[model samples]
Target: MNDISMRVRPGTATALIGRNGSGKSTLLSILAGLVRLSSGVLTTGRPGLTTGYAPEAFPALKLTAEDYLRGMGRIAGLCEAAGRSRVSELLATFGLDSFRSRKLAGFSKGMLQKVNLIQSLLIRPQLLLLDEPMSGLDLPAQHTLLDLLQELKREGTALVFSVHEPQIIEAMADDLYVLQEGQMLRTIHGAENLRSAPAVYIVYTELHPVAQQAVKAVPGVRTMQPAPDLSGISCTGLTVDQKMSDTCLQQILAAGGSIVSVKPLGGLGDLTEWMDPKDQIGSGRG
Candidate 1:
């Protein structure tokens, strides 16, 4: 499972996706040099291209979170003063400033996770390796980390991580690589927004008679029909994407429509199946 090879360019966020036991963690550990690679070459830009790794398991330690982060920065060649400054900055960034001096042994799972992420990010490493940094964080904390990673990418960092959530992958990744059964099945490069091409869907619902006309008036909806019960209606429309689907549905409900269900009209096998190529408008799905 670990004999795979690939390349990632700077300034892109690539998602490493796979089910458990598919070697995602092992691959990350090998990349960080924490585990020995049995064969094949693994290379990177010259030394001083700082690299930081946050393992999936937050290793237990006796030291305070602040100390651990400062130590990592120092080892990465930051002077004592600079290391301390960097650690302080990251502690605040992850909202862990209050717990900075607390011992790791006393920290909650989420608190320790905040420390793990901060330690890796404090140095502003050129190559950032995060193994599920958002694992134990709350929703708001997840957003914070995601925003930070996007900002870091703008500064020329190469970010890569493994995640199980499709929604996060949809929101954050510029490239999605699917790993299955010890092999990389596909590599998809492009933003999720780009994938939100104009696509058609078949929507069915039971709406108030007045609401039926309102749903037909919904901008993206192309057509509608009454079912035999006359209490329900069907809508066919060009939608922006999955995200917008919810908003359009909400509009129907707000207008007094009771939605029965929504199902995409295409299969997921084709790269462009979910998106309507006509609405792509050069934003690109590469």
Candidate 2:
């Protein structure tokens, strides 16, 4: 974790991406105050800031899911009534209401993971840290959790989670920090724009109407629209199938359009290459 500097803004989701043993868990622990930083400053927007942390694994306890959550809520300083209400609400929200009285020892991996997430979300902390949040779940359950997290983010909770799945990163993360051997390798902003498309490239340039039409006429161009504030035109195209990027570039250049920047949107392949070469692209865990 040396020379690491990053910010998790309110209402934004930040993702920690890395291979196994890359200190993702350690960094989350530090942020959650479960582990202390050996050096460097950690500043929060306010004192006594509430933070929730959900680790990758949940212990199998003999207690019922509801009872366990109630105990945790009490430990978090919620009153008995509040604890009961929140526990019930979260259990039902995660589609575990019917199994609230079931012992955690008998629960399946996906059910336990739901309990793990519910516990961290009990107090509705300003900042929530989750490690491998989507480790064990079906597609529907995953979508349910994502929707809940998005609702929390809308209410101004800062989310920081370690993840490997490219779909999760595209669906939730506003910014992504890639870690390798405990070092910050890259910080990618606007991570939400990443799509599952084969390959999408964003081109920034100032172009007249004629040039815009010319660029749009390129075989692979998907869209050509004016940039926000009308500074220039932004062109998006698909590039992987026939390697049409070169042709697109040539078209823009031939139209006398000055290129500002051209970059490909991060996709499954890009994320896999960024995290680790040996691992599969959508394994859903780090």
Candidate 3:
């Protein structure tokens, strides 16, 4: 990492990518002011600048989420009323309101990670540093983090996060620093390599076993899920490629499918899976 030079401006996101033990975490800690730099000039945000950090591991805690968040809010210099309001909004945003009274001891790893992230954003600092924040998350949780990060980016919050998932880096980063052997090997600008976002469309239609199977023949269909009540299934899971959408619609109509509705699919991979009984069949569920 000798003689490494870098710059991250506001209204942008910078991603640090590296293999494990490549000192990505160490560099991130340095950026957060937790690691002392050995030498060389290292410039960062202004003095007295507020920073939000979400570490890889949620620290072992005995407090309930409510108490922990409130305490952190206070630590962030948030007044009681502001802290309470922010906490309530975040709990609902992450679908954790019902578990507000529960202790960290009772939380799943994903829930704990969400709490960690919520606390990080509680202050709305000038800089946000996250280390492997998506490591333990399921697909849905990963999508949640993605959405939140996008929101932060849009708000012009400078982000410097380390992640192994190229998809996330591609999606959120304005600049990427590829590191190896504690050295910056290469730098890639996100806009240069960025591709068009997936043109996902939510296609709701009447259910017919034959039509359902027929629509599966569509070239760009990602998932064909049966709707509840057995009335109609949704093509909501598919990533609608705009170029192929017209062809897909024609194929669906040919398959005797009647459109109930059509809309764009947004955040999360497929949250409908939560309603699936299979979700509770995992090790913890059993």
Which candidate leads in lDDT? 2
Task: Give the worst 10-residue stretch by lDDT in candidate 1.
Answer: 277-286
Give all TM-scores, in the order shown: 0.68, 0.76, 0.66
* Candidates ranked by TM-score: 2, 1, 3
CA RMSD, predictions in order: 10.8, 6.8, 14.3
Candidate 3's TM-score reads 0.66
Q: Write the per-residue lDDT of candidate 3 for residues 1-286, one digit (tens) a residue.
A: 4657788777688887655555577777888888777887777657777889998878748898989999999999999999999999999888889999889988888899989989999987778999888877789878888898888888878899887666776678788776655778766675544334445564556546776666667776766665443343443334565556677677767766665555544332222232122322212210
If the candidates were sorted by their lDDT against the true structure, best first, what order would they fall in?
Answer: 2, 3, 1
- Which regions of candidate 1 fall more than 4 Å away from where they truly are? 45-47, 192-194, 197-286
lDDT of 2 at 2: 84
By summed lDDT, the worst window of 10 consecutive residues in model 3 runs over 277-286
TM-score of 2: 0.76
Per residue, candidate 2 scores C-alpha lDDT tens digits across 120-209 of: 999988999999999898788899889989999999999999987878888888888888767888787875344445455645555667
CA shift at 64, candidate 3, in angstroms? Answer: 0.3
- The true-versus-predicted C-alpha distance at residue 261 of model 3, in Å, is 51
